[model samples]
Target chain A: MSVSVRKTYKLYVGGKFPRSESGRVFQPAGNEAVNVARGSRKDLRDAIGAARKGLATWSGSAAYLRGQILYRIAEMLASRRDGMVQELRLGGLTPAAAQKELDNAIALTIWYAGLCDKALSLLGSQNAVQGPFFNFSTIEPTGVIGVIAPDKPALVGTLALLLPLLVGGNSVVALVSSHAPFAGLALGEVLAASDVPAGAVNLLSGHRDELAKEFAKHRDIDGLLVSGPPDAELTEAAADNVKRVRFCNLSSAAWSKVERLRSLSWVEPFVETKTLWHPVAP
Target chain B: MSGSLSPTEFRVPPVDAVALEARTADLATRSIKKDAKVQGLKLAIAMMDLTTLEGMDSPGKVRQLCQKAVAPLPARTDIPSCAAVCVYPDLVKIAAQAVAGSGVRVASVATGFPSGRTDRRTKLREVELAVRAGASEIDMVIDRGAFLSGRYGAVYDEVCAVKEACGDAHLKVILETGELKTYDNVRRASRIAILGGADFIKTSTGKVSPASTRPVALLMLETVRDHYLETGKMVGVKAAGGIRSAKDALRYLVLVAETCGDAWLSPEWFRFGASSLLNDVLMQLEKQRTGRYQRGTDFSTD
Candidate 1:
């Protein structure tokens, strides 16, 4: 006799798979076969803590090392492409659509990987100042970020928002769309194997509206990406902490161009521009 | 100044390490959530002994710590102040002045602190100095070397001397459980300290790895309980060092209630000797109140 083992769709926080601390799981729609972790605010807090620790090592890492890690994520995704496609299909995606989503996600990863090393020179510049000083502008990752991942085309949608931030060295605590979390959670497995530092990317499967306000109100989430329909509540909460909130259109349809997703617009919002002033050496 | 009875004369039962560990492990699984969780976190906050015992400690740091102990979350008046602010003997005066009007007491560690390597005379003098300097509670370390060498009488006498020198202040004897290395030794030292008149029995100095563990704390609690049953006197238990989370603190509260009954549940009878545990408890309380998780930047740091 053979015993079959089932996969558990748990939250990926701090590079580890843990069921919700609340011990609650929910069935999405009519799918009895899928029970996703109904992440609570406590779970979100833990993800932020892990992301903060990951930020230390990730942001401190050499830009070249970060590039290598992003490339590794792309490599792992390519190897697991078929499995991911099948996983996405479980979310009601057609065979061809699932394949395209995985391919675009992989391609997007590669695009951002190349952008990592060239980020400084390409995004920063030297400026002329009136005084005897060289004024220069540079870029840095904006610490830990919370992303409201787009609901449709889950994998590619999350990566579109995630890759640019990671390329800039910001660790993420993302809340994947509750409707289709299987593929997004599966991506966590790919990132884990890809050598993205433990907490560099965290994913939670739960109601976005419930967690989005929490993401904005959280004092440590230095930046947030609200991906879908505009929420006035999240906007009000982010104002309390002066948290930098960026809204992006990540509907699956928008991701078809792929080129638009690869631009500086995504990377610009997640980076801080620091201006430096130095007297010219005598 | 040796104990009244010979060390071998006391018929203290040998601790069953596995059973002790299993009991404490069972306590760890109990779920204390929502309203009860809020109560426990507040209790954990009140039972905390905010400690800063570094060689580089300054008057400013001690005063700042005292301020936090007084008003952990300045915005919330409902939160109770910590039980005490623990520091070295030299800084007790500063802590006492800082927490003067506040109900928070000043506790100073004497008897050479983490390592009880000093002579008995110097140790007693240190305790006296701390008591004279206005520390309401004195945390003294036992001569672990004497306890380990089978010189139980010497260890017993040192505790007695320190307790005497402490005068009106309560004396909490530190076993430095990490160095004790065994459940049996922890129990024996606890018994020795209790027999010699300790107001409280603490686990570690917060300087050693494995400073406090569940099994060790359970063993100490059992010793205290058994003594209270034998005699009517009750002694407090402080699980110090390495306990950093609100969850871990709640499990400890459960252990105390299970082993020693609800009477030991108060900060007067039990304490957590930790430096970083206060903020985590505050954050948990805030999470309970606001339904949103907290970040470190929102709270003041030590």
Candidate 2:
């Protein structure tokens, strides 16, 4: 006779697994209700703190190396495909839907991985001016990004929202879908096992409502990328810090446009463009 | 008379590290909110020694720091000016000039700060230079090498010399307890500095790791309490380094209040030697006032 091991879903902050500081756990819908970390505002704050520290190294890496790291994430997810399928099944998805979403997530990771180095040239510009000077514009990653993943297709939605932000070199503090957070937690495990640096992508498993206000108001977070309809209260709260807020409604039709999802426009909002003017030699 | 007690005469009873840690942990749980939280936040702000000690420090940076110390957030006049603007001896004149009428004192780090490796003559001269440059407070580092080698007398004598060199200027002796290794050494060193005429006993230079932990600070506070009981003199305690948030600062205040009683709660009795802590305190104050969270970018980074 053999015994099966059960996994405890915990918050991934600074690339380390930690139970919620509040010591509260919630059960997501599954055959067996697994205990997931019910993160608090303090947990979100800690994740932001970690992301801020991780941003320095992640944003400073060469674009090519970042691309390679994203590819490694795809490789890790592919290796864990069976586990992801099982997680999706437990969350009430059909086996076919589970396998499809897992495949889409891996493909999504690879899609963004290919754009890391190309984002700059495709988005940046060299300008012609009347003055005796040279002017050029280039994109730099926003320091830290806060993400709120959607409810359905947990694996693909979270990855679709997160990969674009990460490929642009911004570290993320994401609150996974409350209904199907196990997939996000599993992805976090894959991310940890992959070469993605600790703190580069901190995953918090909790209610979006509990963590959204903090995600908006945290001074350290530079931008917020939400994968649901735009929330008025969240936007208003984020206004206090002037955080850049962008929404991605990833519908089935939207997901079909893989090229559009992997475009420079997708990565542009998560980055700031700096235009430098230098004096020309006579 | 050297005005220094013989190191052999002062006795530091063995500290129960476990009990000290437990007490600190218990005090950390006491929550202050509303009016008390606001009052504690303001007190923490006033006790800050807005410090910038870096090799790359410039006149422009010192002037900006002094401006911050004086006005803090210009729009919020309710926020009190910090206790002092701490900098290198070389920047004392500029800092003094910047906060001339603002009541923010200029404190210069002297006596081979962060490391007391230089000779006594050079260290005393450094203090004299800062005093001449209009510094009202001197933050000096003790000779950890001497203290660790059982040369307690040498360490006490050096602190006394630095105090004499300070003249009217208040002396803040940085024990650099992170380098002191053990809690017993911290206790003994605190006793020696208090006996040697340190107006204030500081925990660290903010340059070393393991700077100013809670249990170590609690032990130092106990030493201060015992010293008062023994000698009838009240010495100040400044928990410097690693104290960033208003919550952490308030915990230190709570430690002081519970350990040394309410007398040590004032800026005159307790101080925080911090550089980036001011802005965070201001942000928290703003949140309390407006019931809204703030961003770091909104505050000026001097």
Candidate 3:
């Protein structure tokens, strides 16, 4: 009998793969035991620190350049499509369904990449005034964002929620679904090779119940994107820092609606608007 | 005072790295919550030496730091002010003026600070200038080059000279343990600093990695305990750098209480050399009171 080699899926932090500080691991479906890093509150704290440090550089990049990087992510995903599809199939998805989901993930990434530069024009405004002054309003990224992925359709749902936030030039610390964590780990590998800056997108595979309160209360995170029903305790904790929270009801809406998923509203929640005025002489 | 004795006369036993790390890990698991947590948070706040030692530091920045040291959170009167404001020597006068009536002492980092590479005369002169500019405390760095080269006597003598230059001001000797590899070096450096007349022995300059780690702080606290047992003198310990959160600060508090007893818990015997740690502690205190976390923008940056 021949022995097959297996891979250990570690958490992506600061653009590097590291085991959990707690030194614990869990088995996701279709994978061997001790593969995924079972992250703790300390791991969450370290991820937040990495996101904060990457914010200045990621948010300061040109919109066009950011769009190019997002396109690069789609290309990387496409090249690794076969491996991802196989992993998804082993995690309980049918062959045809797995292929469709992979296609949707790539399409959604490209769609968001194209909208990076155009979001400002659609969401911003030029105010009309009676005085000799020119005024305008513009949107800016809201620093580091925290995300919680839903369990079902783990791959597409996570990409749909994450791409919009990244397109808006904000860094993310995402906690992948505990049920199907292998798909998220595969995506992390693709992101590492996609020219995405280190610390721009960190992925953690662990129990959501253990980390939700930390995601809400961490002082460094500026906004949160949670998929599924609104959690009362988590929402209340987020109020302590007055951080912005958006809940995506994946069960209520169709996941294949590209127009709805790619709308400007999805991007608006993670951005802040600033209005500027200047006096013009006659 | 003991000219006949050599620097190598005092000896420190070898440290068990694994055992020391395990002990620190166990102490970190102690849960401090509710009333006890609030008290710990307040005590930690009172032990802070709010520091800013950047090259870009100006008179205005030092004044802002002083203001922050005096009234950490003005809206909440229950919060106690910090122990002192730390800055470079040139800005000592400005910092002193900013906290003139606030009862917050001014501390200055001398002896070429992060790197003690200069001559003894220059180092002593720097100490004198800071004291003349109204610095109530001087934080001096030990010459790691001399100590690493097996010249323990030179390192001890330099610390003594800086202590004399401080006059009546309290002296804090920074070991810069990150540069000094091995636990034995840290143990020996702690002994040298205490016997050479350090009012308080510090762990780092906050400019290097592995600054003020739990094991390092634990070892230094033990040194203070042993020194007290032999000479009947109580020396303080300051854990600077990389201690950012309230939970970490609480762990240091636990180490001090468990090792050296509660006598060293007060600000006079313990201090935290940090700048951003104050805001995190305030946020936790507010969370305890309001049952919610606070926005960073609600607090002042300085």
TM-score of chain B of each: 0.98, 0.97, 0.98
Model 3: chain A TM-score against the true structure = 0.95
lDDT tens string, model 2, A1-282?
A: 999877779999998999999999988865354788899988887888788888888998999999999999999988988988998887788999888878878888898999889888888899998899999999889879999988877787788878888878899999988998888888888998987888999999888877888888777788999877788988998887689998887776676444555666778789888999999999
Scanning candidate 3 chain B in windows of ten residues, the lowest lDDT window is B1-10
Each prediction's interface RMSD? 1.7, 2.6, 3.5
Q: List the residue pairs that clash in candidate 3.
A: A240-B293
What digit string (tens of lDDT, one per residue) describes model 1 on residues B1-302? Answer: 56556767444678888888888888899999898888888999999999999999999999999999999989999999999999999999999999998999999999888797889899989988999999999999988888888888888888887888888999999999898887788888899989889999999999989889988998999899999998989999999999999999999999998999999999999999999998889988987787656778788888
Cα lDDT for residue B153, candidate 1? 87
How does residue B32 of candidate 1 score in lDDT?
93
lDDT score at residue A115, model 3, on the 0-100 scale: 89
lDDT of model 3, residue A128:
91
Task: Give the Å error, residue A122, model 2.
Answer: 1.6
Q: What TM-score would every model get versus the actual structure?
A: 0.93, 0.93, 0.83
Candidate 2 segments whose C-alpha is farther than 4 A from its true place: A30-32, A130-134, A250-261, A278-282, B1-7
Report the lDDT tens digits of candidate 1 across residue range A99-125.
Answer: 888888888999999999988888899
lDDT of 3 by residue, A98-199 (tens): 898888888889999998888888878999988999988999988899999887676877788888888788999999878887788678888899878888
Give me the runs in candidate 3 sitting further than 4 Å from their true place: A1-50, A90-92, A120-137, A146-152, A173-185, A202-221, A224-253, A275-282, B1-34, B112-114, B117-122, B144-146, B149-151, B208-210
Locate the minimum summed-lDDT window of 10 residues in model 1 chain A: A248-257
Give the TM-score of chain A, superposed on the true chain A, for all candidates in the order listed.
Answer: 0.96, 0.95, 0.95
Q: Give the clash count for model 2.
A: 0
True contacts kept of each: 0.64, 0.64, 0.36
Displacement of residue A150 (Cα, Å) in model 3 is 4.8
